[model samples]
Target: MKAKTHAEEAAAFIKDDARTHWHDETLWHVRSNRDRSAQGIPEWETLRDTASATKNYVLSHLGELLEQFEANAKANGVEVLWARDDKEHNEHVYRILQENKVSNIVKSKSILTEECGLNHYLEKKGYDVVDTDLGERIIQFAKQTPSHIVLPAIHLKKQDIGEIFHDHIGTKKGASDPNYLTEAARQHLRKKFVEANAAITGVNFGIAETGGFVVCTNEGNADMGTHLADVHIACMGIEKLIPRAADLGVFLRLLARSATGQSITNYSSHFHRPAKGKKLYIILVDNGRTAQLGREDFKNSLKCIRCGACMNTCPIYRRSGGHSYNYTVPGPIGSILSPGRDLKQYSTLPFASTLCGSCSDVCPVKINIHEQLYKWRQVITENTNVDKSKQLSMKVAGMTFGKPVLYDLAGKMARTALKITPKSLVYSSLNVWGKHRDLPEVPKESFKEWFKKNRKQ
Candidate 1:
C-alpha cells in the first residue's frame, strides 16, 4: 500500500470542517492556558534558560553521565541496559518478559514504546499487552496509534470515545457523559492493573547523579502498574538524562505549565530502585539520537521534555492533527526530528510548518524548532529528489529575486496576468495554493513603481 503524504492526510483531516475547527480551538485554548500559567511565574524565562543550558551540558557529557548513571543504578539495585536502536530495545524488552515468564503486560503512556512499536511486537509474540493510561486505553480499544503525545486521543470527541467504549467495554451505546465514561475506564483498567505480569513506563527525566528516573502522569497509572506488576521496565531515550537531581526542579516546573497549564503533574513518581523481590530494568535507547546529536543544528531538539507545548502552539499541527505527520511524535518538533531519521521517507515533514516561530516561543526548553525546520528544508532540497514543478518554481523564484530589474518586471507581469486571467484558469488544478484561498485583487502598479513615484514627490 502506498503511504499518504502529509498533504493528503492533512487534507483528509480538514475535510471535516467542524472537527478541524474544534481541534484548532482546543489546542489554542491549551496554548492560552500556558500563557496564563507562565505569566503567573516570575521566573519562567529563567527556568527555560536553565533547563536549556542544563540539557546542553548533558548532551556534551552524555557518555560520562550514562556511565555514571549505570554505576549508580547498579548500586541502587536497578539494572541498566543500553539499546542502540529500536530493534535492540524491543529485543531486550522481549527477553526480559520471556525470562520472567510473563504473559500479560500493562503499559503506561510511553512515547518511546510507541516509537519502538513495543505493543505490536509483543502482541505478535502472543503476549497480551494493554495500555493503562486512559487516553492510551481509549486509542488501544480503537486499535489506533496516538494522534497526540500527551493527549493520545485528543482527536476523538466524548461521543467518539463513548461509541468505542460501548463496543469494547459494554458501556451503554448512547452514553457520552465524561464522568460516567471515566468511571467505566477506571473499572476496566483496575482489573488489568491487578493482572499484569509486567509494567512498562516512559521516563520523563533521568537523574544521572542519583541514577533515578521520574515518570510524571496525572492519572497515576504508571504507579499502579509498577506497584502491582512483578517486573517493572522503564524505557527512555538517551536524551532524557539530566546531570543532577536538583536540575529536575527546573524541568518539573516548566513541563506541566507548558503542557496543560497545571502547577505540576498530580503524580511525579520517582523510581531509584526495585522493591523487595521485584525486578526493575531501565533501557536507555538511542534510536538515531546520537546521529541527531552530531547534527549541530538539530541536536537541541533532544532537549525537548515531551511537554507538547510546541504542538499546542503550532498552527499547522492544530489544524492538520497529529496523525497527519505520520510519525510517533508529531508537529514542529517531529518535523525537525523525523527528517534526520530518514531524509527521503520523511522529506515532506519539514515542509509542513509555516515557519511562524510560535513553536520555539512556547517550547519549555527553548529549542530552536522553527530554525531547525528551515535548515532541514535546505538539506532535503539539496540531497533528495523533490518534485520537478516545485524545483523549477523555486529556481525561477531565486532567479527573479536575485536581479532587481527581473523582480520588478516579474511583479508587474504578475499584476497584469491576475487582472486579465479568467478566475477558472487562475484557480485551476495546477494552482494548489489557490485551491483553498483566493488570490488578492491585483494592484494598479508594482510597489517599486509606486515607491519610485512617491519618493520623488
Candidate 2:
C-alpha cells in the first residue's frame, strides 16, 4: 500500500539483494520441480489443451450449465445461492451465519473469500472467522493479505513468522524450526476446528453434470472442518464450472504438480452432498466475472485453475514479491486480471511484466497470461484516464517515431547527451530509471549506423 507503482515497491524487495535472490531461486526451484513432474507425464500438453477446451465450453454455456448445476444440487439436497457481487455475496454469507445462530467459523484456504474481503467484513460484523490453512492462518494472524494466492505466506520468512507466532500464539521465543512451528500451529488450529460451529471452503471445480464441487488441499483441513461443523458453505466464482465429473481427471492431473510439485494434493475432496445431519450451501458468485467474460482478449483468464504455475515461471514475480503487485492474486495472471476490476488503482499492474511469455508456457490451462498482460497495457493506456506524464511521454514517442529523420536525430542527440552528461546528474533524482539501476553506456554506433557501414548500402 505504501508504494504506488510496481517499480517503487519492487525496489524495496531488490534493496535486500540477498532475500530477493533467495525468493527468486526458491520459486525457480518450484518451477524446476514442476518441469520434472510434467516430464513424467507424456500427455501434459494434451491435458492442457483439453482443459482449455473444457473451460471454453463452460464459459460459452455458463447459464445453461449453472441452471443444470442448481437443479441437480437441489435434488441432491444442497441449497444453492447466487450472489451478483461482493457486497451481496458477503451479505448472503452473513445472513446464513445469522440463520444458523453461529458466531464462530473455521475456513479452509479460499482466495474467493479474500477477493470478497469476507473475513474482514464478517469480523467487523462481530463474527469470529478462523483461517485453517497453515499459510492463510499465518497471514491472518499477521493482519496481512496473502502474498501469493496458493502459497499465501511465501513472502514471510520462517523467522518473521516465528516472531508473529510467539506474540500471538505463544510459540517459544526464537523457535523458527519448520517442524516445531508447524506442530505448534497444528495444536492451535485443531482446537479451533473442533469448536467452530460453521465452516467454509473454496471450490476448486464445480461439476454441472453431477452437481458436486471439488476442494483440493494438501492439508485435510477442509474435510475436518466441514465434518465437525453443523453448517458448511462453499464459495466459488461462476467461472469454476467445468461441465462434467470426468473433466476432473485432466485438471486434477495438472493442479498439484504445477502448484507445488506434488502428484496431487493430499486431499482432493468431492462434496457431493452435505455431511450427514448438517446443512450445506454453495454460493455461486458473479463478481465482475461476467464483465471479464465479455472481454475477448481477457476471457481466457477465467480458465485459470489457480495452479500458481504462472507465478513460479514469471521473472518479474520471482524478483518482486507478491505484495509488490498489491492485489489478491499476484504475479502474471493477477497483473492481467486486476486492471479489469479497478483501472485507476491497478493500471500499473499490466505494465509490471516484461512480456516474457513464460507464464503462458507454464499455465495448466493455457491462459496466454503474458499476451493478456501486453493486451491489458494497450487497453489501459488507450482507454483509461492515465496520468499526464504517461500521456505526454507517449505523445512525444509517437510523434518522434512517426518521423524517421527526427528519430535518427533524436537518437544521435540522446547518445551525445549521455556521453557528455555528468555522472552526478546521470544518477540524480532527474533520472527515474537510473535511480535504482546504473545507466548503460551508450554504444559507439546505432544498429542502423553499423548496418550501413558493414553492408556499404
Candidate 3:
C-alpha cells in the first residue's frame, strides 16, 4: 500500500473504522476487565495514588536512578548504550548489527522502535527486521503505521488481513477466519524467530534497584524472540524506570486491566541477566524525553504505561483515529508528549481533545491529562508563531474582552452579524460544527440586557 499523509490516512481510517460494529464491542469487552478488577480491590484508588506518586518521585531523581541502572546492567554482562535521539538510537543499533555482521533480526513489539523508525531504518541499511508480535507483524506486512498502541492493526478486519496475506504472503484467497489467519502468522514468525541471529524487544518496566527490564506480552513473543536469538537488544526510554520490584506490583495489578481489561497480562517476563549463551544488550534512549521530564506541567505524562486506555476511552481519539495526532504514541498521551519533541509540528494534537477527563479517570497512574492539554495550549500560544487566523483572532478577542464596554459592543455586533450572514458561512466552511450539530438560535434579547433591566424591579 502507498503511504498517505497523517491527516488523510486518519480521516479515511476513522470513516472506514466506524462501520465495524466489532471494534467498539471489542474495546468495551476489554474495558470490563478494568471494572471487575477495580470492584475487587477495596483500595484501587489508593493504589493509583501510590503508583502516581512513585512515578513522579522516579522522574524527579531520574539521573541518579539511571546511573544505578546502568551500573547494574553492566555488572550483569549486558552492554549498555545511551542514545541522545532517534538518529543516535538507530545508528547505535545499526552499528551493533554491522559489527556483528548480523543481517536478519526478530523484534517483539516496541513502540520505541516504531517511534525511531527502526524497522524502516534497518530495512534501508539492508537488514531484515521481522516483527514477531502478531499485531505488529500484521501491520508490518501491510506497510502501515499502527492505528492503536496495544493492538497495532486493531482497525483491520480479518478479511482485510486475509487479503493482505493473500497478496503479500501467498495465503489462499477467501480464508478470512481470524483463527486461520493468526495461525498462518504464527507459523511464519516461528520460523523467523528460530532462524534470526539477533532479536530486539521493548522494555515495559526497567527496575532501577535491580538493573533489569520487564517485557510483557500476551503471546510470549518477547520471551520466545529473546531466548531463541543469539543476540538480543531491548530498548527503553529513560522515563520507564521504577525504583523497586515491590513498586511494580501496584502497577502490574492495574496496567493490563486499564489497558486491555485483563486481570493481568499473559506474560510479564523480567530479565535481570542474559540467558546462558545469549548476548544481551539494553539501549536507553532519551530522544526528547529528558526535556519532557523538565517541563513541570507536562512531566506527569511520563507515567503512561502504553496501555492505550486513554485512546480507547477518548471520544476524539475514536472519532479522529490515531494518525490524526501524527505521533507514534497517539491519543491524549501523544498530545502532551509530542509537543516536547516539536511544538510547532504537533501543536494541533492538544487541540484534538474536547477537554474531557475520561483519559485521566482511566489512567492507572492518574495523569492529569486535561491539565496538560491546557498547559500545552498556553505554551503554544506564547511561542508567537501560531496559525495566522488563530493569532489574529486571539489578538482581537483579547483586546475586545479586556474592556467591559468593548466586550458588550462586540457581542451585540456579533449577534447582528449572525442574523444577517448567509447560512452558507455557518454551514460549509465552518461545517465541522454543522456536520454534527445545529448552532443555538440567538435569543430575542441579550441575557445581560434583560438581567440589568429586571433584576431589582
Candidate that would win on lDDT: 1
Among the numbered candidates, top TM-score falls to: 1
Q: Tell me the whole-model lDDT of each prediction, alpha carbons only.
A: 0.94, 0.91, 0.85
- Candidate 3: which stretches are off by over 4 Å? 1-17, 20-33, 395-431, 440-457
Which scores higher on TM-score, 1 or 3? Answer: 1
For candidate 3, write residues 180-292 as lDDT tens digits: 88888888888898898898999899998989989999999998888888888899999899998889998888888788878789999999888888788899999988888
> Candidate 1: what lDDT?
0.94
Model 3 root mean square deviation, Cα atoms: 3.4
Stronger candidate by lDDT (2 vs 3): 2
- Predicted candidate 2 versus true structure: per-residue lDDT over 129-165, tens digit per residue: 9999999999999999997888898878899999999
Worst window of 10 by summed lDDT in candidate 3: 1-10
For every candidate structure, what is the RMSD over all alpha carbons to the true structure, in angstroms?
1.4, 2.2, 3.4
What tens-digit string does per-residue lDDT give for candidate 1 at 1-457? 8778899999999999999999999999999999999999999999999999999899999999999998999999998899999999999999999999998899999999999999999888898889989999999999999988999999999999999999999999999999999999999999999989899999999999999999999999999999999999999999999999999999999999999999999999999999999999999999999999999989999998999999999999999999999999999999999988888878899899999999999999899999999999999999998899889999999999999999988888888888888998999999989878888778898777789899978
The alpha-carbon deviation from the true structure for residue 105 of candidate 1, after best TM-score superposition, in angstroms, is: 1.3
Report the C-alpha displacement of residue 453, candidate 3, in angstroms: 12
Count clashes in each candidate, considering only residues at least 3 apart in sequence or on different chains.
Answer: 0, 0, 0
